[model samples]
Structure formats: C-alpha cells, structure tokens
Target: MRRIRVAAAQMGPIQKAETREQVVARMIALMDDAAGKGADFIVYPELALTTFFPRWYHADRAEADHWFEAQMPGPQTQPLFDRAREHGMAMSFGYAELTPDGHHFNTSILVDKSGAIIGKYRKIHLPGHDEYDEERAFQHLEKRYFEPGDLGFPVWRMLGGIFGMCICNDRRWPETYRVMGLQGVEMVVLGFNTPSVNSQKGEEGIEQRMFHHRLSLQAGAYQNATWVVAVAKAGSEDGHHLMGGTMIVDPDGFIVAQLGHEDDGVLVHDCDLDATRFGKETIFDFARHRRIAHYGLITGRVGAEPPPEE
Candidate 1:
C-alpha cells in the first residue's frame, strides 16, 4: 500500500497591505502544523502569497506586476523550500508568475521531498474577462493579467505515485483532469481563491458556490480515479469574502478530510495511491473505454455549435 500523508493547508485572506514576508510566515506556521501531524506532503492555495488583486482593475496593467513572482524560490519563498527540505515534505502551491520574457501566467509548482521543483503547471482555463466590465459586481481581470497557459496538462512520477498539478479555474474544467488522467495520474493537487458569492449574480451565494466547488473536485477525482487535494485561500479579503473549502477527495469521489472553516488551518489525511487502481482498471479505464473518434468537436471547435434547430 503506497500511502501518502497529505496536508491541505487552507489560508485566510491576505489583505493588500500584507507583505510577502508576512504571508510566508503564516504559511510556515501551517507547514509546521502539518509536519507535527506527520504529513509529508502539503498543499497551499493559489496566489498563496498575496491578496486577490484581480478583483480591482488598473488602467495600467503593469501596476500589478509587483504581485507577480519573477522567481519561484526567490528570497521570500526560500524559507518555504528550506522548511520543506528540513521536514522532508513535498509541497505544492500556486502563485502569479512573471517570466523574464515578460509573459504572465497563473502558475503552480510541485516540489519534491528534497525541495527540488519537479513539475510546474500554468493554469489554462483562465476565467473572467480581459477588459473591465461595468456589469460585474466586482472585477475579475484574470484574462487581462495573465496569458492563457502555453504548457499543456502534464504529469509526473513522485511519492510512489503519478502526480499532476492545476490551478483555480483549471479545476472547474473536466479536460484539465482527463488530459493528465490519460497519463495515468494517481493524484492531482490544486489551489484556488474563489469568491464566496458570484460576482455576476450575488444571489448565487456561498451554498451554491461551494456546491459547484465540491462537484467539480469530486467529479474530477472519481472520473479520473485519482486522489485530489484542493486547498483554498479564503476569508474576508479586505471585505470581499472568499469561500475556503479545502478538502481531500479519494478515488471514489468521497471527501475524506475537509477544512471546517475559512481560516488558517491544516487537514491531514492518509491517501492510499493503490486505492485508485480498482476504479481505473475497471470503470474508468480510459484505454478501454475512451472513444476519441466522436470527440472531434471537443478539440476542433472553440464554442459549442448546436445541431440544426430540429
């Protein structure tokens, strides 16, 4: 039995005024807690170091560049790597990436037990509009701030299991998992910063939003026959609330462990990678069940084309 003690570290909101140093301190605290709980693998939420700045719009996009990380383990984040190495823990987390070439992406990385980054994933399914819209209750300018990920869904072998990474909105799309699932990924780790209420429709409150959140993760895990660790950066970020529903879902889509609130906390669980074999070899065996011929429309078209109105 290949068992990985995983920790989902859910962080509270980081207000705009908080520095990366302050945030890293908080993350270290959570990491310490996970270590105490005997967790060798921990996951932190998306944009784990800063406020959800995309909620505000800027006439000059470059003004937001300060929020992007030019280097992964650059000064401020080095401590995280050091602590992971000290504890022999593998870690995954999300942040905004600014490449030296000037490309920006919503990115996540997988660090091995020795603190070496083994894999990186840029979020592909970027949600929200590029331009500021008067209709939105709040701005979500992800498209304006980041380029659609050029790197496709990729998987790696680690911790005696196949691992994959995705970020925030990428988790909402089935394609994100299937692509890695095709590679026989045994586990998928992700981080998200989701608003508690729908910016488009306030009536769609936390209940509905959380429902969709769990629905997406659960479906992705069960369908792919993989374990899923979803961490959230949630709470009132300068008055705008983010729903923190950090959880660990098993291969059967059951939530084995979940954070009870939107606060700085850790939920640790022992995930058996072998638990995935039954479903994968039987019901979800893509090699035997996937019919690609009929899926042309999935890749061939950008938008859904309705069959003749009949």
Candidate 2:
C-alpha cells in the first residue's frame, strides 16, 4: 500500500463574538502543528472561522452569510495558504462559501502542497428545518440559510493521492461516498460542527450524536475502502455543547487516530493509499459487483401526477 500522512485538526467553534481574523490565525496555528508533526496534509472541520450561526434564526440573508467567505484565498485567509506553501504542507478545510453567483454553500476546499487550489466540494446533504420550530431546543437553519450544493460528488487527485470532501450531514448518506468510491478515491476529508444534542427530533440528550458521527464515517470507510479523516469543531461554545471525538479511519475501517477532548488539537496518522487497491480489487470491486442495470428506479422519475394525463 502506498502511504500518505495526514493530520485531523480538531477544534471548537469561534463564538459569535470572535472576529474572523482571530479564527484564521487559530487555523494557521493548527496547520503549523500538523506540519511540525511531520504530516503532509491537515484537515480542518466545517465553519472553522465562526460560531455555528444557523442555530438562531436571522431575517436578513446578508447577516446570515456574514460568516461565509465570499471568495477563496481572499483577504484574512491568504496567510493560511502562504504558510502552507512555505512549510510545504497541504490542507483541506470546510467553510461557508458565499459564491459570487449569488448562492451560499457549506463547502470544502482542497489545497496542494504548493498552495494551489485543487478542488472544491459543495455539501449536498443539507439538514434542519426550513422554518423555526419553537418547541425544539435549538434552531438549525441550514436549510433556511444555504442552498443545496449544485456540484455533484467529485473526487480530485492531489497531494499524491485521490481525495473527496463532504460536510457533516452528507456523511449520513451512503451515496455520498459511493459516488467518489466509484471513481477510485483513496481518501475522504470531511468536517462538522454538530451539536451534542438533537433539538428537532425530540430524543434523549446525546443519543444519536456520537452514533451518527462514528457510524457514518466507519461504514463509509469500510464500504468504500477509503481512508476517512473526519474532524469536528467540538466542545462547548457559547451556550451549546458540540460533540468532540475527532478521528481518522484506515482503509480497512480501523480507527487508527482519534482525539479525545475536542479542544484545539491534531491527530496525525500514516495513511497508505495502496491499502485501498486491495479492497477495490477484491470485496468492493465496483467493476465486478455493481449492478447498475437492475437499479432502474435510481434514474426513473417518480411523478406525482399521472404522466400529464396521457
């Protein structure tokens, strides 16, 4: 198996009170730590720049996108790229993208060792209710704030390996990984800002939080035979507590690296890209096992009307 070293940069959120410049500095520090630890690439969690703002309802769209970065490699974040270039480190990070085309998305950017933008992934799975639910504990206004990702699942070759990115909720879906797996992706880098409690579902505290986190990543890794590096903006920020437990899974689904406390930290792992080849050629071989011909309904349209009365 060909090897590639990686670091999962796990940290808690920047409270709504904090500024973007301060958060970007924090991210740079994490990149330095990962590079200091001999890692070739570092992965940071979603919305790493600001507090999880979608929890509270906002009437103005501009205010909602205030935390979103209008452009990549723009002001306040160029330092991260420059530092990565100087240190010969590559990084993957998730952020709220305020696209110039007039859409906002929870997106991830892949940067190579030379600080080149290799790829960008817009989150496809958007969670939370469209309107505020008063009975719930906390509000999740992601659907209210962001448009669903327009870009379908994509895999990119960079930093000496093939990689893919998906935000937190997207990990819950199997097709998220299957699509990239079909492309022979060797690794997947993803981030999340998941709260420790689920307000909308009306369940016990913390029951499904960790379960969904680990289960999704594990199954994705095992089923697709790819390395999964999932970092989280964990710990209690503001009044709410976000789940911590940042982790990395190997090609065979083993939890190779994990962070316990969720405070700003890094988990370094030696990942072998070649390890995935064995699985792709054997158990999960798409060329030999995928029966696309039988799954017609996947492409079939389930019309609500009776075929226009034909």
Candidate 3:
C-alpha cells in the first residue's frame, strides 16, 4: 500500500495591491496548517502568487513584467522552498514565468520531499485571446501575455509513484491528462484560477461553470485511472469572482475530499497509489483498449471540418 497524504491548499485570493511577500506569507500559513494535519504533499493553485493579471491588458506588453517571476525562488519565493524543506513535504504550485531569453509561460513545478524541483510543465492549453475584444465582459489576455508551453505533458517518478502536472485551462482538455496517462501516471496534481461566470455568456453562471469543472476532473480521473488533486485560488479578486471546487478525486473518479468554500483552506486525503492498478489493468488499460489508428484526427487536424452539402 503505497500511500501519500496529499493536501489541496485552496487560496482565497490575491489582490493586485498585494505584494509577493504578503502572498508568500499566506502560502506559508497554509503550509503550516497542512504540516500540522500530517500531509506529506501540498498543492497550491495556478497563479498562486499574484492576482490573475491576464484579466487586464497593457498596451505595452512589457509593462506587465512586474507580474512575472524571472526566477522560481527569486528572493520572495525562496522561503516557500525553505519551509517545504523544513517540513519535508513535496509540493507543487503555479506562477507566471519569464524566461531570461524573454519568453513568458504559465508554468508549474513539482518538488521532491527534499525541496528539489524534479519536474516542470508549462501550460499548453492557454485560454482566451491575444487581442483585446469589446465583446468580452472582461479581458483574458493569456494568449497575448504568455506563449503556449513548449514543454509537453511530461511525467516524473516521485514519492513512490509516477506524477504529472497541469495548470488551469490545461485541466479542461482531455489530451492534457491522456498524454500523462500514457506514461502510466498514478497521480496528477493541478491548480486553477477559473472565473465564476462565462465572460462571453452572462447566463453561464457559477453553477454551470462549477459543473464543468467537476465534469472535467472527474472524467479525466476515471478515464485515466489516476488520482487527481486539484487546488484553486478562489473567491473575489478585485471584484471578479473565481470559483472554488478544490477537490481530491480517486482512481474511480469519485471525489474523496473537497473544499466547501472559496477560501484559503486545505483538504487532506490518503491516496493509495495501488488504487490505480485495478482500473489501469482492466477498464482503462490503454495498451489493451486504445485503438490509435482510428484516432488520427485528434492530432492530424486542429479545426473541425464538416461534410459538404449534398
């Protein structure tokens, strides 16, 4: 029974006025709580350190440089590494990354119990448009701010199991999980900063949005036969609300533990890596069931094509 006690650390929100120092302090407080709860691993939400800045647009894209972290542990974030080392807890979190060569990506990292970064995944499925559109209720300039991830969905062996990482919109795509699932992933940890309402459709409120969130995670978990720990940076951010449904899903896609409110909190559960074996060896055994030849369209084409009129 290879078991890992994981904690879904759901954050309340980070206002634009909040400094990295203040945000790190909040993360540390959650770490303290998780450690006390006997959690050996902790997952924090996407854009964990800052308010989701892509919501705002800058005429000069360079003006948003202040929001990007040129280095993962650059001064303000080093304490998180130190605390993880102190608690000997493996952790994962997301942030906006600015490369030295001037590339930007929405990224997440996985650290081992020793506080060493073992793997990194840039978000491939970036949502929203690059150009500002009056049609949107609010701007989501992710395409303009960050390039799509160059690093593919890579998995790493850690904590006695194979683990994978994805961020926000990446979770909404099946390919994100399937790629790692092919690598025999036993666990997938992800973070999200999702708006409570659809920016384009006013009728699509929190209820529908939350339903999709659960549908994505649950389906991904069950189909892949892996445990999924999803954390959220929730509540109101500068008057724009982000939904919180931080949860831990089992191999059968059942949510074993979930956060109740859109607030700073942690949900811990013992996830036995062995739980994945049954489904993986049976129902979801890709080697025995998947027919790749018939799936060419998934990768062969990008946009949909319709049949010609008779």
- The best candidate by lDDT is 3
**Per-candidate alpha-carbon RMSD to the true structure:** 0.8, 3.1, 0.7
Badly placed stretches (over 4 Å) of model 2 are 299-310
* Clashing pairs in model 1, backbone N/Cα/C closer than 3 A: none
Candidate 3 collision pairs: none
Give candidate 3's TM-score: 0.99
The residue-by-residue lDDT of candidate 2 on 1-310, one tens digit each, is: 5677898999876787988888888988888888888989989998887788888887676778678898889888899899999989889898888877879888899999999998999888899977888888889889988889989989998866889998999998998999999988999999998888778665645657787778889999999999999999987788878888689988788888898886898999899898888888899999999899897765586444355654
Lowest-lDDT window of 10 residues in candidate 1? 301-310
Name the candidate, 1 or 2, with the larger TM-score value. 1
> Which residue segments of model 1 deviate by more than 4 Å?
none
Better of 2 and 3 by TM-score: 3
Per-residue lDDT of candidate 3, residues 1-310 (tens digit):
9999998999998999999999999999999999999999999999999999999999999999899999988899999999999999999999999999999999999999998999999999999999889999998899999999999999999999999999988888999999999999999999999999899998999999989999999999999999999999999999999999999999999989998998899999999999999999999999999999999999999999998999
* Model 3 regions more than 4 Å off: none
